[model samples]
Target: MKSRLNVVFTCFLLLPSMVFAEAQSRPRAVDDFFANREILATVYFTVGSAQLNRAGEQVLDKLVPEIEQLDPDVHLVRIEGVHPRKDHDRMTELAMLRAKTILEYLHHRLTVPVDLTLTGSSPSPEVRRAGRSQHRADIVVYDNLFDPHTADTNEALSR
Candidate 1:
């Protein structure tokens, strides 16, 4: 009876700490970027144009209201841009322009300030073939304020 009582006491003592640790370890809500929460619009550019054509503008218009509806406490935003394997110069210029253009659109239309992140990389250093054209202009719209694949998150958490 004493041993059983001790086991119950131990579990009782540990339960709250276990619950606290689990709560802390669980991923934050902003990490739900993969689940497509905060990012409302993702615009992929053609070869050399940052100009939002009719379709792009239409997407932005729809996204603006959705973004505004999020809770005020959510302040994270991520904007990533990818480069094409061919015609590097044209795509690089367009990607950079697209990143800036996205930020501007969010600010002007959504009336919300967001922390922005930008990533630029070629589809491949050496162009292979025509099979991977869509990979050329890969852009992601996510709400994660930090890159989960990098050390930045650990460093930030430590601080």
Candidate 2:
């Protein structure tokens, strides 16, 4: 009886920690959770400038409605800015600036927070040879339409 009581007490003591560990291990953001299901859109930019030209604006105009229809709830929009330049630091800065510009344009339409990623130029020789295509920003819209049901099923399966 004493041994059984000790075992029960030990389990009680560890229960909270186990729960916490599980929670910590779980995907924290909506983006991370629904990363697999996403819509990608690209906005091209001029070299060495973060300004959104006519083409970029046109891309965003079409992209905004698609994103709105995907999920009404708060979703994650990942904006990755890519530069053609070889300078990592400068490219990163330019990429970030471009991402921010895109984010600002989408902010009014999107209720959810936007995550930015400054991905420098492609290291691939083929892409490097491809020219101006690398000077673009890729927007990944992560939708969460079926997240609740999926989460419930996942939780049930985990247990």
Candidate 3:
């Protein structure tokens, strides 16, 4: 009876800590960028041009209200330029510009300032073969303001 009483007491002590740990605000899957990010829009650009075309603007126009609905302080934004690597230098330069252009567009449109990260990378071989899919900017949003994959989270997890 004493051993059983000790077991119940130990469980009572452990339960609250487990509940609090489960309530941690950090994203459940820290390293999963695709799982963590909310894809707001995938706007495409003309070949060699970072400028927003008619369809791009229309897509962005639809995006504005959705973004405005979120509190800028709690949400994070990122623009990823999906340019597949080519033998020439133009694609790299063009990709970064495409990401920046989308961010700039967001900066001008959002009523409140949003935390934005601009990134550009060559798409995977599969995406590279998708033709028009390469010259694109993906607008991603996250509920967490800071990056979950940052060293801060990794360090905490290690402990």
- Each model's lDDT: 0.51, 0.62, 0.69
Clashing pairs in 1: none
lDDT by residue for model 1 over 1-159, one digit each (tens)?
A: 978954654454344335445664655542343456344456666655666667766776777766666543344454444455424555554555566676676678767654454443444333445444432222344443444543366754753
Tell me how many residue pairs clash in candidate 2.
Answer: 0
- Candidate 3 residue runs with Cα over 4 Å from true position: 1-30, 72-74, 86-88, 129-132, 143-159
Sorted on lDDT, best first, the list reads 3, 2, 1
lDDT of 2 by residue, 1-159 (tens): 978954654454344335445764654453345445464788888888999998888888888766665543445456767666544656756766787798888876565544433233332456677654777888875544344554567753543
Q: Which runs of model 2 end up more than 4 angstroms from their true locations?
A: 1-39, 72-75, 85-87, 109-132, 143-149, 152-159
Among these predictions, the greatest lDDT belongs to 3
Candidate 1 TM-score to native: 0.49
Q: TM-score of predicted model 2?
A: 0.56
What pairs collide in candidate 3?
Answer: none
- Cα shift from native, residue 42, model 3 (Å): 1.1
* Candidate 2 C-alpha error for residue 25, in Å: 17
TM-score of every candidate = 0.49, 0.56, 0.65
RMSD of 3: 17.7
